[model samples]
Target: MFTLIAAMDENRLIGTGRGGLPWSGITRDKQHFRDYTAGKSLLIGRRTFEEMRGWFRREDRPIVMTRNPDYDPGGHCRVAGDLDDVLALAADSDGEEIVVCGGAELYRLTLPFADRLVLTLLHADFPAREGGVFFPEWENEDFVELRREDFAADNQASPSMTFLYLARRAGSEHADC
Candidate 1:
């Protein structure tokens, strides 16, 4: 199954830059990603791919979707010019699974295609901006809660944040909210 796991906030700010900006000040979310994605295929945008470039490869690649035809694979990985291509390649992979690690725009685009979501809902987003570049929101009936994990008490710096694993229901459209 195709899965997308993200660490975001209640205000829904997924990221501002690349690797350097994730909510890594917290550790449980980090461990969840590591444990979940260590040996799986990951799908990402060019910027996200570049951010984690040195750490991944074409063979163990996190696939990148881009418009630049000149885009280089750099290794045994794959690149797609559009969503159809991304979905096709992911579905055809021997493992039949893909995980998305992102910058928010990609999340917005991928939500319609994803089957499962692993989210870390932070207590707050940026102060004034609050939320930026978020995926379309879905109602509670749209998903089934598979699990929830509380962050360590010491990390109350963002109290409302809670980690969640939700499976999107079949036949749903992730319309923009």
Candidate 2:
């Protein structure tokens, strides 16, 4: 399953800068990402790839989609210049699943290509944040609630966090990797 895993807020904000993941000061979000992506192939944008160097040195390594070919992170981090190239690489990989990590524009581009979504909904309204990116809409009916964890208001992580494991309806995918 090609899955998109992201932590987001109610107002539809993911990040503000070029490629920042705007999770509201939640430590659990990092854990969530790390756990889900531990032994998998993580797809990311150019800036995200740069920010997250040496973190995803998993057995499978990670694939990064960027505009530059000079991005040589060495060891396991492969760069795909565009969506088609990224899809092609994913298509050929032996792994049954791929984790689509984001930086906004990359997420939007990946939406149409994904078969599942692993989302974290943070129930805290944020103040005036700078311009950021949002996740593309996938209807509620298309998801299956696999796991959910709720946090108290004073919790160090978040007030109320919901982890969603959403599978695209059968036959939604054009091809399988």
Candidate 3:
């Protein structure tokens, strides 16, 4: 099964022109991501993979999605042309779950196939000049909140954040809106 993981601001902005996360200093949220996706196979876009290249642990298997067959991630990751290819690879792996780590486009493309969503919702807004990369919007009725933990704004750059775990409700159609 696929579990999508992401962090977004109140405006749903996930990235800035700087090419990484728009916000910083949320160490707890970062740790939550690490703990949750520790041993899972990860499906991520090439840019996202590159941005996080040095941070992946040895046990994490990243399946990078890119159209360029020649592009090399230079790590222990497998390269795939699309999400289907990534899913096929995950199906063959020994891991119990596949986590879709993103660059907005990938999340928008693969969200329908995700069985769970682990999200960090920052209470602050990140306004960009031409708008920034956003987490794909979804309907609340399609998912049931499995868990929620709220953390107050820390002394650093983070805002009040809520970590939410959601599972797709049974019988809900996985349709992209």
Over 106-144, each residue of candidate 1 has an lDDT whose tens digit, in order, gives 777777676788887776655423334554575777788
Instruction: Spell out the clash pairs found in candidate 3.
Output: none
Backbone clashes, each candidate: 2, 0, 0
What are the Cα lDDT values of the candidates? 0.70, 0.72, 0.85
Query: What is the TM-score ranking, best to worst?
Result: 3, 2, 1
The TM-score between candidate 3 and the true structure equals: 0.93
Global CA lDDT computed for model 3: 0.85
**lDDT, candidate 2, 73-153, per-residue tens:** 678678888766766676777656778888677777777767888888878755425666676776666555666676655
Point to the candidate with the largest TM-score.
3
Scanning candidate 2 in windows of ten residues, the lowest lDDT window is: 168-177
- Distance from true position, residue 25, model 1, in Å? 3.6
| TM-score for each predicted model, relative to the true structure | 0.78, 0.82, 0.93
Q: Identify the runs in model 1 with alpha carbons over 4 angstroms from their true place.
A: 17-24, 57-59, 124-132, 155-161, 170-177
lDDT of 3 by residue, 2-33 (tens): 78999998888999755787866678888988
